[model samples]
Target chain A: MTGVLTVVGLGPGDARWLTPAASEALASATDLVGYGPYVDRVPGTPGQGRHSSDNRVEVDRARFALDLAARGARVAVVSGGDPGVFAMAAAVFEAVENGDPAWRNLDIRVEPGITAMLAAAARVGAPLGGDFCVMSLSDNLKPWEVVEARLRAAVAADFVVALYNPISSARPWQLGAAFKIVSEIRAPDTPVILARAVGRPDERIRTEPLSQVEAASADMSTIVIIGASTTRLIGRAEGEAPYVYTPRFYGVRP
Target chain B: MTGVLTVVGLGPGDARWLTPAASEALASATDLVGYGPYVDRVPGTPGQGRHSSDNRVEVDRARFALDLAARGARVAVVSGGDPGVFAMAAAVFEAVENGDPAWRNLDIRVEPGITAMLAAAARVGAPLGGDFCVMSLSDNLKPWEVVEARLRAAVAADFVVALYNPISSARPWQLGAAFKIVSEIRAPDTPVILARAVGRPDERIRTEPLSQVEAASADMSTIVIIGASTTRLIGRAEGEAPYVYTPRFYGVRP
Candidate 1:
């Protein structure tokens, strides 16, 4: 009665963004595990056991799901964005790899989903047209020294940034600190984009001077920060959406 | 015989990433116009019209498509990834917006597609999980001074970077110069990611120190640069692929 485990990405927010493959994986699962909010995203039906909890307990939840699978329950561990991108996929894998070897034989499949970075990039046009990097601001697991070092390195490298988990109640100052590091290397006018709850209702995305990011309502659910080389504040008239973009090899324009 | 112009995104190189909506848009179009390489990506068909050309002539080619649409050919202005992201979608709109008034009313639909950034991120296992930035090193359309200023600004801000068009035959040194800017403000040992031909059969993605980038076989087709803020180089043992990720939030388990 050994059950298999499949980790799925629900995509940014819209159910339309859900891939058929992901749906099929979840449908075949006897139980689903994820953040309580993310659990609501699964298509509800009878006969599917759901395990939902607060966000802070990802590792514990992942372990719980693995336990179910170890007990032979077909399980699906889901995440809002791509399962691998700052989601539950990696945790599930880590738990399995480090846990008892008995669970290693369980069939594990990872289905990729659209991440917030790409979705937000699309929503705001093409600021991410080229080589860009995404980074989180929270420093609970990693040392702040490490975060600052990377920020300095990234800023010095002139990469456009997509910031995730930019600000939370306990860690509000960290984002501002990161902003200062980038500001030292970038101009005051560099565009800092704030994409809130991308692809979800109540989503808000706006671009402002890099110096003003601290003033924005950056929160646990918010993705914030600046664009690097090649990013520009596109005029609103370019399309229905006002966005930022790093022009890619434009001189070759025919 | 007014023809409609539809812009579609072919998700990150994998066929699985293609959104159903994007697939439907491509199927509905009578003809496809795009860069030669991108045009080849359209799924196989016996009679679909594919107008392909070199990458150098994208603007001319896109404009030509608009003219064809005006002449009543239902043309699909296809670009690899998303059209709006440094691709030809906006160029198409710009051409039409400034073109003859008779061409203004044609139905133009812009469908979101998978961009390279997402494909690269997925391959690397969430290098862009949090706050990040993207930039290009090409100095053809904009002056190097402008590019430098933007780079400096981004550096000051500590954003993770995605570099598009990092090097080419005409501008091989541009990326190096950008690296110099990054080095000015960052540590020499900071992690830099090089993702080549992402999503293609020849895909190569690796993370190394900032100084090693010049020695790498980065070319016009390469996407290069560093992560900022919280990004760190995970051990190669994480998987066959290397990853750089910023910690998620202030208090999440690794």
Candidate 2:
């Protein structure tokens, strides 16, 4: 009996952003596995077994799901945002490449979901409307040198930069370091967006100039967007949030 | 009788990829406006009106939507993929910033959707799992020199690159030009993915080595992805497609 392992993305936060495919995948899953919070988001399906673990042990969780699938259990590995973007899809493939050889033959599929940057970008207007770069500031997997080099190149290339995993208690200064690099290469008044828990009830979205951006406000839930040379902020009425966007016309304004 | 203009993304193509928020917006919209094909994808609602036009007339379509909203009509400007990513969201915002001052005060919201690159990446096993850049190769709006410089910088930084609008009838030579630049900075054996019309019935996904990629295989519906230095392709059984992923460890095997 060939079992199936479908990795699912739960979108950023809201059920409204969830795709029908992901919702259906979750509904039909006999076994669900993922980080505690992501798995908790899915409503209980009677008789469906749930296996939740810490996000740090991605490979172990992946292996456990693969093991279940290999034993004829249809499993779904849930992830926040699109599984392919700094999420569970890569981890599952890594497990397959290095784990039991027979595991490679199992049916595996990844269902895409709305990523944080897109959801966050929507709330603040179209800040990622043009060419852009997405990078994780977390240095747990790679050296900080790699992040610095990539940031410099993206800025030079004039791609709007979206930074994931911006800061955590362990590496609080990383966001500031990124801002310092951006300050050097781009204009001080360029638009900056900090969107925290965008789709959830406690969602907060703010727009500030690159020079005065409040880096300390960002948490694990925050996604930071640094505008390119052409990124702009359109002012609205008093007490109203500004609309942030990067025009498709490249260096020119509307 | 203040009206609302909601910019909604319809994902790549399939209804399964469509989000509930987009569906609700489409259903409630008094007027729908977009490129002819994208607008046609939305199921017609009784008493609802649609304004479809050529893809080239983005700003004009945006203005029409704004005009409808300003006249107390609930309007939805439909777009393929996340409206923020090289789609209609920026165009609408551009229209607002330049059109009428009163347009800025009208209630405008952008609902996000799964962009093409993410959908394409998911089907190919997470080629965009790590640091990445999204760029459009069309030189219609921006100069070719800008595209050339950005491509060079993106490759030098070892960021996985997802190129949109890779080729169109008017810009037949651009994709080849980009390939030449990429070949100079990266290994020829780098993985390349050609995902055309993902999620749609006619979707076709093909992977190749950078040196052997068929530039002519792409059309306007296609999205081209070039792997980074650490990206790998895991071979499967005969006739089975391989899984391509960039590990989170960055330049290191898991």
- Every model's DockQ, to 2 decimals? 0.23, 0.79
Give the C-alpha miss distance for residue B238 in model 2, angstroms: 0.9
Residue-level lDDT tens digits of model 2 in B1-254: 39899999999998999999999999999999899999899997999998889988889999999999999999999999999998999999999999989999999999899999989998989899889999999988898899999989999999999999999999999998899899998898999999999989999999999999878999999999999988998888788899999999975543
| Candidate 2, position B84, lDDT | 95
lDDT for model 2, on a 0 to 1 scale?
0.92
Q: At residue A56, what lDDT does model 1 achieve? A: 70
Candidate 1 per-residue C-alpha lDDT over A1-254 given as tens digits, one digit per residue, 9 for 90 to 100: 36888878888787767767678888889999989888988986689999888987877887898899989998998898777567876566566555766655665666777777667666655566544556666687666885787677666666566666777878868888888888889988888777888778989877788766664467677776477655665443335444456655433432
* lDDT over C-alpha atoms for residue A221 of model 2: 95
**Residue A192: error of model 2 in Å?**
0.9
Considering only chain B, report the TM-score of model 2.
Answer: 0.98
